[model samples]
Target chain A: MLLQASNLTIGYGNHIVQHHLNLVAEVGDLICLTGLNGSGKSTLLRTLAGLQKSLGGHITFRGKDVGKLTNEERAKLFALVLTDNIAVENLTIHDLVAMGRLPYTGWSGNLSANDEKIVKESLAQVNLLHKSESLICEVSDGEKQRGVIAKALAQDTPLVLLDEPTAHLDLPNRIEIMLLLRRLSVHTRKTFILSTHELDLALQMADKIWLMGNDGVQVGVPEDLMLTGKFQETFGSTAFRFDETDGHCKINHLLGTLTVAVTGESPATLWLERALFRCGISVVPNADIVIEAHQGCFRLQNQEVHSIEEVLHHLLC
Target chain B: MNRTYKNGLLFTGLLIVATIVFACDIVFGNVRLPLSALWSDDVLYREIIYNFRLPKALTAVVTGAAISVAGLIMQTLFRNPLAGPYVLGVSSGASLGVAVYLLAGSLLPIAFVQSGWGLVISAVIGAVLVLLMVLGISFRVRQAVSLLIVGIMFGQIAGSLVTILQNNSNPDSLKLFVVWTFGSLSAVSWTYMQVLVPLVVLGLFLTFFIQKSLNGLLLGENYARGLGINIGRTRLLIIISVALLAGTTTAFTGPIAFIGMAVPHLVRGLFRTSDHRITIPGSILCGATLLLLCDLATQLPADGYTLPINAISALVGAPIIIWIILKNK
Candidate 1:
């Protein structure tokens, strides 16, 4: 057991956001904390990072009470990559990552050769070594995020906690960050606990999911939680349905006045059904007007159309 | 390696400039004395050099270094570019103390109230009182910006109190109070330098101990804490150090302006890095040099009349700050 928390309650003064939480993270486990907005994902992460005081219960890291440890001791045990944007001017990526060695450095924060090697290695791990001399403000947001992750890596802690590491990133950048974290966790054998709203990616990638719901925190393997309908129970609404097989929360379209049958190749048909759903034309097995969607063109009533717009125009007209 | 070499050159150049300015400030006063006059047998020149010019020049150097370093710490602690030594109302508090003593001290029958030490003691006590209040508020407020706002409010309240005291003062005392507000490096005699030098030295020394903490704080409080810094303790030490440096300087020099607020920005621009290790010493040297130059400018007319050091600092420092802003933009 790397970290364990039993009967933990976390909140601001006089207002409890979460309670009766029993959570455990083993060595090398990528635990993804997921929840609705204001469901205490960040609060829990902060409490676990020892940045905030837990209202009740105890958090033990390596069988020792975390609250009893000194800040320097805790810093060696776990590092954090915060969500807050670092807008500090004139700080280079290398300089920012070098600060992670401060705990082990001298009073003046002069990095030793060994510390420099570690900082360089950390930057390389995040693929930011090439841009090490770039000022923080001069870099792209993805590069800045990588620089922050590099800083956390240079801390050389056994556990890394990230609060919404994927937030504010586009799709490819988000996937790249997640993949990098996963790779680091596997290669370094270090535990990572991150809170994120990316349910699809979290469900596919995380070793375990800590779903913070209305009742309490439900901890389980991602597949097990999905198979047991816990994801549906927690996140299912009138507007969307959680797909158990694909591990996706898909929007539930209302039945429309017009019905049309979508046919042909799977991926194309899938988008055609979506377009029909959006245009208030429900997809059915049989209809007077049938549309067959190929890769590039749509065959609607034996008349070929080049785009979904033409198909929608034929159906609506 | 290249950056370090450049910084070394910058420090060396600044030291040379500061030395030249210090010598100029000492030699080119109201009664312009030649370099050979220091070794002359003339009793009047010796008296002027040792008793008046040397102490005043030293006071300007110490005042510049102390207040500029205080401003740098406050800027980092509050993470506000505009933050300065007096941002926490320490100067205004000292001003209020002097106002009450000079304008209202006649009501008290004590003999000590009329002495120079009475004014210094009162100013320090007033500054500390405000510091204690600000420190108390800091513990309750989580954000540095909030503490900054509270400090500004404290300054406003203290300024209002000082104005009220001035309105009711006698003309003789009013003239004295107004002259004190004009600020003078020459007013600090050798006796005051004994106290001022050590306090400023101690404050600057304390800053070296927190050099890493100040750098960590530049990333903001949460990140600093994650890096194993105790934010509350760092803030307390920084606040105390600022109070000591700014409060003591204001007490002796009567609240010299612009040097504290403007010097750190100049040093930061020159260094092109926020690393406290560089900026701390850089600020000390740059601040001392800037004030020395300003003080020398006040004596440049070579007339017997001297301009207020406060006015000279503003006139000289403001344009440099404006240039830095425009260059950075």
Candidate 2:
């Protein structure tokens, strides 16, 4: 196992946020952790990164307890890229990324030719090479996010855990960030686990998904998850339904049929549907259709009401 | 990288400026030494330069550098732009310690001779005690506002205690405390300078040596922790450095204001980087220049009178802070 949490209970004070959680992550996997806000996802990641202490169980890295490992030992295993920008008003890109070598550098990074090469390549990897001279406070939101990733890449840990890495980015920036994580997972053969709200994107790139829901947490391949109809049980309520087979969410609204209807064979049928929609009536596309000429409609099955009075009676009924 | 070079250049420029300021400082003080008239064998000139004036200027420069660098470290570590050695109640706490020592001296014969060192040592202890209290409050409160409020409240408490001590003391002791409170470079005699300068040098040397760690601290605690820095340990190092730098200066100069708080921000504004490797050293030079300038201004001695150095610094520092905030807006 690259990193393992065994029977761990993590929380603040006596509150007990997550209890008896067990998980193992292998190298070279793109893992996505998805949940509602305040579901203890970030806390779990912090614990795994050794920033927070577990209440009862232990986190094992390479078969050794994480707490017992030296600081150097922990640094070799994981790098945590936080969501907050840290706002170091004066730090340069190169200098910020070089902070990764602190473990090996002891007191000074003492950048060897090799260290310099690695730092340059890391910036290039994130497409931030041009911003090396830029101060942290001067960069845009997207560039700041890239700068953070570059710092993580410089650390070059086997397992990288990011907390809501895409939380503050725009749509395009979010997709690009996810793709970057995917590439890093493959190119370096490192495991990347990130907690994010971009579920569709997370589902797209993830090798394995950790989905937390009302039905409790589940982890599996994306296809397997979709096949099991977990979304319907989890996110779907009375008002919302995940069209599992169709792969889209739908809302069901109740409104009686309109007296103003048209034949499917005519162009007027489309106009009739639009007219009903404008009147706050949902046009269930495949529902019954009636042709209205001279302000009268009759049911095909019952052969009834050919007048406006009968249609008004039906609406009252 | 450009900013680093810019910082280096600015720092050099400031060094030349500091030298000029120091020369003007030495030349303009109460008994002006004629720069052209003094020879190597001139007895009065030697006495005036070595015994009286030279130590004061050097003390001003070193105190400025030390206190400013210390303030920068405090601001960075706490991640609060408003944070300073004096702001965290250390100065008031140190004052309380001095009050204790001065008050104790009236009842005992040994009090007068040992009182000077006694005030300084107790002041350091008092500052450390308050630092711990602030640290404790910071741990419990995540909001910077609450922590700052607690700091201010703590300062009030220390101030009241020091007041009580001052009122209960003899007339001579009250006079000494009042002088200390006003803040001065002239009161720093050679013997006192011997103790003060070495402490400042040592504190700053240790801070510069840890420049890499300071840079890591710029990246936030989790990012820094991932790089194998023991966050708890680094914070301890910072506190110790702040204590040594602020404590020693407060002990000698009687809580000189604004040097620690203002210099770092001015350096950051000029050099435009948060990286401590340059910022720390840059703040030191800016501090030295400002202090020497203030020292010189205090020595104008119009009609045989001099201004308190603290008054001059507070007048300058308050608006620089207000300006930085407004500019940021």
Candidate 3:
């Protein structure tokens, strides 16, 4: 194991957010830490990353107590990417990434040729080598986050920890970041512990998931946790329900007992069902009210509606 | 414009400018010693050129470099654009320290806050006291903006204290204190230079050692800690270095203004890089050159008397600060 946490309690001051947490992170494992806001995801990450002292219990890296390691030693073992927006001006991606070599570069921090190569390799890993010369202020938010990850990779630690790496990113960019992290974990065999709100993506990509809540912490593979109904127990709410199979949230509005039969499986049919479900109505295989949804149009009860809005209006009125 | 090329050009350009300004500051005064004056045999001219102007010029250079570097560190440490040695109350604290010593010399032994070394000691004590207070508050208040407010409050409180001392002071002591507050480059004779030069050089040398850590700090405290930077130790080191630079300069030259507050922004604008490796040295050079130029502007009227150095610095510095705010906007 690259890292192990046993019987751990994590929190700030006297407030305990989680306790009795036991987990092991092996090399190449991409573990996603998922929890509601204030549920100790950040606190746990901070404790494990050695940014804060653990409230209780033992955390070891390669059989060495984390608390025993010097800061330089811990630095060689773990790299971190934080969610803080960097307000630096005129700092280039190259300089920012090169800073990761601090522990290795001695007091002067003058990067040697080997360190330079590592920086380039890290930036290349994040596909940001082209922008290495560009000032940090010139980059988009996603690119800047990637540049920060590149900095972590340049640290050359055995483990990487990130907090909300996907926050404030567009869908494609969020997927891109996760895929990049997962690929890096596999290719480099580095242990990764990331706390993020990208649940569906985390479920699809993570090797293991650390679920935290008021009830406590649950550690298991995504599928195992899903099968055990832990996801539903942790995330289900009056306004939303967790879909275990797809690992996504669905609106929990109560639908009327009456059902409508939708004719086909297509974009139009999907929209028709979505519209019907949104109006507290469900579509089934058999019902008195039948809708034929085809290319760009919907035929509801023998009347054609040009748009979903019109179809909803006729169906409800 | 490639970043490396731009940094290189700015560095080389600033070096040339600093050297020229250094020479200009030494040569241009009531007695305009030409570049050839160094070779002349007139002893009086040599005395005026070497003993008088040389020390004054060097003091200006050292003062400019020291305070601006301290300002850059404060700006980075607090993650605030407006944060500087002056705004954070380190200078005001130094001012209050000197004011107390000058006004109450009968009460507190004269040997304690005497002249050259005495002022440096008192100023450092004052600056460090304020620094400790700021650091104490900073530990509890995580927000850089809030910490900035605390610094401004410190400045206000220090200013009020200095005003109280001024009111009670005798006219002779009061005039001296008021003149000191106006600030001076000419006041640093060769005797004071012996102390001022080494402290400023040492403070700047220490900066190179912490350059990487300062870069880590630019990412904010938690992230810096994650990178294995001991934030508490680093913060203390920065405060001490700033104190040495700012307090010593304030002691030797009195409360010279604006270089500490404005030069870092001007350097960032000129070089367009936040990397402290570049910014620290860059601010040092630009600060020295700008202060020298401002000193030259002070002597431009050639009235045998001089304009207050603080007024010239503020005239130059205040506009740059406004430009930065507008640019950021």
TM-score for chain B considered on its own, for each of the candidates: 0.97, 0.89, 0.92
lDDT (CA) per prediction:
0.89, 0.77, 0.85
Predictions ranked by lDDT, top down? Answer: 1, 3, 2
Better of 2 and 3 by lDDT: 3
Q: Which structure is stronger by DockQ: 1 or 3?
A: 1
Clashing pairs in 3: A90-B274
Best by TM-score: 1
B1-329, model 2: which lDDT tens digit per residue? 55447666787899899988987776676776677534557887788777777888888888898889989987877677878877778898888877777775656567554646776777777787887898776767744456667877888999999888877888998897887788878767888888888888888888877777777777766777787877666666676777778878888887888767888889888877776766878888899899898888887776357899888888777788888889987
For residue A209, model 1's alpha carbon misses the true position, in angstroms, by 1.2
Q: Output the number of the DockQ-best candidate.
A: 1
**DockQ, candidate no. 2:** 0.53
Number of the candidate with higher lDDT, 1 or 2: 1
lDDT of 3 by residue, B156-262 (tens): 99999989988888998788678778888988888778888998899998888898889888889877877778787787778778878887888777777777878
lDDT for model 3: 0.85
For all candidates in order, state the fraction of native interface contacts they contain: 0.51, 0.68, 0.74
Best prediction by lDDT: 1
DockQ list for all candidates: 0.66, 0.53, 0.63
